[model samples]
Structure formats: structure tokens, C-alpha cells
Target chain A: MTRLSSAQRHLVRFTLNGKPVQGEAEPRLLLTDFLRQTIGATGTHVGCEHGVCGACTITVDGELARACLTLAVQIDGCELRTVEGLAPAPDRLGVLQAAFRRNHALQCGFCTAGILMSLDHYLRAHPKPSEAEIRDLLSGHLCRCTGYTPIVQAALEAAAELAELSRSDHRDV
Target chain B: MKPAAFDYVRAETLGEAIEVLAQHGGDARIIAGGQSLMAMLNMRLARPKVLIDIMRLRELDRIDSTSGSVKIGAGVRQAALLAWPELATSLPLLSKALPWTGHAQTRSRGTVCGSLAHADPSAELPLALVALGGELHLRSAGKQRKVAAREFFAGMMATARADDELIEAVSFPSGNARCAFREVARRHGDFAIVACAAVATKDGVRFAVGGVADVPTARDWPRLEGSALDDALNGFAHELDARDDVHATARYRRDLVRLIGRDLVREVLQ
Candidate 1:
């Protein structure tokens, strides 16, 4: 292995949530670490660092990506959205998060954030997904506590809520 | 787990990337999506002295179709390829196989060329590439060459690519062939114990199996119906002599191969 000095840090600038954020990171620093440590977006949890678990999932440039597998430098100019960005207000939960809570989707809550992020991205593209489609989307995420039934229920409810919101937005337009 | 300390260079263009690869020799590893490489690095399975970040090589991130053939550049992510509107009509086999490659998040960051280069025996991309009979374009500092997919994979986690050569693009011939991909994994997104891809064209049918051997192997079969195709696949499965591991016994894998092969062939024929 080639040893770089501990002082080595590269500057990365990217849009976090709706704000532009910049930080110094090692080239090998993962995007998960960058979000959690440097920018203090700790809502993006890290379970399996090798990209198996979806705990470190986030959206980069409107696409769902595994933060554990992405380098901080790779998203220099990209827009990123972590779990923290899910809520419309600082204190209130987003539609997906509220549906997850209402449906008892989380037991341990460790996997909830990742699931929320993934479902948020999926539901954006598929506003009214079926239960089977929700289950297929959740297959990417590993949830040990919820037995996946409640999580799937949460996703289905969230999809319904999102579809309603889209319809209302269109009506308002 | 974190990756070991290494020098990182973001190559701007293909020529520059090839120069860096040539300069570093075997000490460097090229990273596009970094899905597989990051996992290997975190596990200490790969210890490269230099990481050539080819993610910025936008010139290679194109999917071009010309004369009934599609050329996908190395930097093209799996999800991007899947999202391509023309992919379903141009390369139906790849379109059918991409969803099984990984989850949405991983596919968003994993590149098609990266999967081909990683060369895991259980990986779906290589199996699909072989089944589709794709061609890999490799480039060095001063030379470029195209290799057939059948000859690209050497063994488990090994390929015919030279240390200095960079996979520039992969090309697949376009045809309206009926294709099907089937795999038996422990879970929805997990690696398959045995996977098969079958494509039936007017000429003949081609079948490739993964996770049963060191590398995905493909065989051409004549158009046969019913029990004849099943018997041929059964014979082919026995000839594979797949290895045994913690996940499954060699016999189980062979059986899976035969079953999946038959199913896929039937789907293609229909």
C-alpha cells in the first residue's frame, strides 16, 4: 500500500440539501464519512461499509447511490440528499417518514433512515407503487428488525400519500 | 472498514487515464463507479499504490448505437444504461439483466465496465455479456484492441485484461432476439448460486451460466423443442463440473444450472 501523509486532504464542494457545502477530505474518504463527520449529516447511518446494507444510502444528483461505495471527491459538484433532508420542516417528518411511523415500519430505527431515503427516491419516480413493487424496492435494503412486512406497508402508504400530494400540487397549478 | 492510504489522481480524459495506468503499471487501479473496488479496498482485498479516478472521464460515458450495434463506454453506470430508452429495443438481453445486477442504489453507482473488469464468477453483468456475445474495447498508452466477451474472462475474479490496459468500452451486436435471465440467489439482491442467460435468435440459441464455475461459460445450442433441449442442458450441466462452496454443493449448482437453463431457454423460445 502507498502511504500518504495523514495531513493529506482534498477540498470537495457539493450541494448538500439545498445549500452548498464544502469540506476537506482524504481522497479515500467515503461519502458516508464525509456526510457524517465533516458535514455532520449523521442521519445517514453506516451499517455494512461494503455496500450490502442500504444504511448508507443517499441521493446524488437526484439518483439513489450508496454513500459507502462513493468517494467524497466523486460528488464534488453533485447535489446530495441524506435522511436529514427528508423532512419539509425541521421538526416535522416528511410524508414517507410519517407513514413509516404510522405503519410501525421501524423497530430498531437503524435501517429506517436508509429505507426512507431509498423509498423517497423510488416513490418520486413511482408515485403509486403496488405492494409487490414496494417489496421489490425494499429488497435492496436489509432490515433485520421489522420483518419487512411493516416496512412494505409503510412504503405502500407513503406511495399513496405521495400520489395524493402530486395530485394536489397539479390541482393547485 | 476504511481503505488503506493511497495516492489518488483524477484523470481528465481517456488519453490521460491511459497514461496514468501505463505509468503506474500494476501498482494502480482504475475506479469508475467504485462499487466493487471500494468494497475490496475496505476489506483489504486490494492494496493498490495509486487509485486512478476515471469517474471524471466524461468522454467515456456514452451509449452509442450505429449499424445495429451498441457501444457503451466504460464510465456508463448500470442505472444509466437501464434508463436508456433505446436499450430495451437495442439490447434486450442487457435491459432484462440490469435489474438483477444489484439494488437501485448500487446500480446508480456501479458501472457496466467496472462489473466486467471485477470479473466475479457470480456477477450477473459478465454472465449477460458472455450470453450476449459482447466485445470489450481495451486501450493502453499507445495501443487499443477489442476482445470477444467469451475470451475476456479467465477465471474467478480474473480477466484477460492486461494490468496496463483500460477497458474503454463494450460493444454488443443489436438484434431482435428473445432473451431471458434467471438466477437462484439466497435473497432478491444477493449473488446467485447459479444463474443462466439464454438468447434465442433465428440462427440458434445461446446459453451462459454463472456461479457454477470459475468463469461464466456459454454454449450455442441448436433449436430444439421440449425434452430435447432439456436433455441437452442436462448434459451441459454435467459437463460443467461446477465447484462446491459454503453456499452450495457442486451437485446443487449443476442442478440449478440445468433447471435455470431449461427455464430460460423455454422463455426465449416463447
Candidate 2:
């Protein structure tokens, strides 16, 4: 189903969020450029651009990847998510975003979105994580401002809050 | 940080990847999970005119055990291998060393053969592979060859693999041994300044050192039993030629080579 188009350009088609999107790009086009420039999702930041920093992280087919390194044409049959597409709807904060707000997880807010995306996916899979586990999971993410304590606290608080909400849902059911 | 413009080819099968490598020759670079290659490409340390992505070669992504050997495909990711309970129970040295290679996110994309190809002397997998006495499988157009782990690693960031060949899988025998890996690094997740993997078998013990050699070294064979181990442990400090690094001094690395080596020997033999 997948084959090389030609030397210079390759046409790729895949769904971004709930919408079908397609693009023709140079073979050297990074996925970050395709997302921010071609697809206009500015939520994905190109931090470090060299993969040393995790600010360029995004979920590709439910796995975290540095979008700056992944070529645009590589995700032809993949599901991609940038922080801009994170909310239930546009311009709205999701559970992780709201958790950051209430728990003061962000300061300068540059790395917050990528952290949220990574943590959001992690929390969805793991509704509750211990403090050490939180610290361990956040090793890849670096936040110069908040000292990471607040972010760690935010994740813990969010996990507890979500557990309480889920417990109430079970009782109501 | 844009990579140089090049042709992109997705190899659906390992054969396709081999053919692409043969056709493209020196112009090609094979990417398994793009963990190390991507970083290198961005830094301009490595630039190839053609990239052959072998990530979708599902036929090559596997880990299995036979009667006396365990086979691990080259395309197996580091995180996947770290999560393998079987490997942990069977090969704890590898499990202990995986976290020392890179951060969790990077390890999620890094692959075994990818690590071998990158051949960072500070890397943990190579030392572990050396102590484990593994074999490397190399394949090219119409030819396949096997190289012992001791032979595959030639120098810094180098391997015995031909430009037109790709690693297939690594098979290692279980020698009824107890293995352990230890290291000192700048931080918990950073690359090791000095690391060692030690395996103790019925006949003898094997000690492999990384981060100290241009290429990692595995020695201390012929079973330094009892007084011999004590002598080595006592004077092991002199055997190393460690160079200064950002995280450690040459003298400190030399001492650590002995100290950690002795402790690991104790953990293995006792």
C-alpha cells in the first residue's frame, strides 16, 4: 500500500484528529514543519530541533516521538496529535490543562503543552501514578521555571482528582 | 536543523531494505526507529543521500527463545526490550544497563541493531552484549555472514558490517550465569562516563568495560578464582587507560574500573 513516489516529492494522506488531511512535501520536510507550516498547528513547538530536548514531542499513533526528527511522509497511515488538537473541542482546556491551571503546573508555559500532551496520554493510560513514578515519567521533560515540583504535584493532584471522579461515576452507575 | 535533501524509501521487507542498501550503496543510511540516526542527521554528523526506513519490516521485529539460545531481532526497540520480563529474568545485565543509555522518550524509539550500529563506546548495550557472548547476523545481497560480538565491534562508532549489509538478529547462548551491570554517569539518565558488565559462569568470569575504550573491551576471562580475583581486584586499578571526560577524571575512572569491577565480581561469584 505504501511505496516511494519519486526523488523530490512524496504525497502522504492521513487523518489529523478527526479530519482527513493530505499533503505533498519534499523528502526532507520535517513533520514539525508540516504540522506548523503546512497543517498550521502551532501547538507543536520545535525545541532543540535536534531531539535532545523533549519540547518537540508529539503522539504519533499513540506513541511519543520528536516531531522535529520524524519525516512528514513517514506517518502516511498514522494518527497524529499536536497540543493544538488536544482539547475535546478547539480553544478549550482538557483535563490535564485544567489540572495544570488548578495545581499551578506551568510558569513560563513554553514546555507545559508538550508536558501536558505526554502526561495527558500517560494519565489516560494510567489514571493513578505514585510520586516516584511521576518523577520518573517526567525525566524526559525539562521545565526551567516551575522547578518541576509543582508539575509533579499537578500530576499527582490530577490523578487523585480523576480517581475521585471515576469513583463517583462508578457509584452513580 | 533541517536534514539534507535526499530520497526517502520505505523498505516493506528486510529483503527490500537489503536491495535498497545494495542499490544505493554508500548513499544510503538505514533507519530502524530513528533514535540515534535522527539525532546524528540533525547534527550533520551523518549525512546520507538516501534513507531506507526499515521500521515497517515487521518480519524482523521479534524476540523469541529456543532450547538453548534466545534470539532478538535487531529492530527491537530499547523500551520494548527493557519491558521484556523474559530478558530481565534471563539477562539482568541488559535490563540494568538499558536505562543508562538514554532518557525514556528516546529509548522508546531506539533499537538494538541501531545501538550496535551507532557503536557509542559509552553505550550500555554493547558492553552487555559483549559480556553475554552474543553473535551478530549480517545480511547483504545474496550473502549472509555471522560475526561474534567480540569481532563485530571494531572501534568508536564503528562495526564490522559492510555498507551494503544490515544486521538481521543476535543470538546468544545462556551459559547458566549470573550477570550484573554498573556504571557512573553525570546524571541518572545521561550517557555513562564509565560502565561495566560482568558475567560469572561455571568455568570463569567475563568483565567488559565501556566508556573507557575507543571501542569497549571485555576481558577478565579464564576465571580469576579466589586469590586471583583478589589480586585483580587489588591491582585492577592499574589495568585501565581511562581518559578524562566531563563527568570523571582519568584516575577516577581507572579506580572505578577496579572498585565497580570488584563489587560486580562479588555480586556474581558470591
Which candidate number has the best DockQ? 2
Residue pairs in clash, model 1: none
TM-score of each: 0.94, 0.92
Predicted candidate 1 versus true structure: per-residue lDDT over B115-162, tens digit per residue: 999999999999988988889999998899999998999988999999
> Runs in model 1 with CA error above 4 Å?
A1-7, A170-173, B201-203, B225-228
Query: Once superposed on the true structure, which residue ranges of model 2 sit more than 4 Å away at CA?
Result: A1-7, A170-173, B175-177, B221-239
Residues A41-93, model 2: lDDT tens digits: 78888788776667878888887787877889889879887787667666576
Among these predicted structures, which one has the highest TM-score?
A: 1
Clash count in backbone of candidate 1: 0
TM-score of chain A by itself in each prediction: 0.92, 0.88
Clashing pairs in model 2? Answer: none
Q: Candidate 1 lDDT, tens digit per residue, A16-80?
A: 98899999988778888999999898999999999998998889999888899887877888999
Candidate 2 lDDT score at position A160:
77
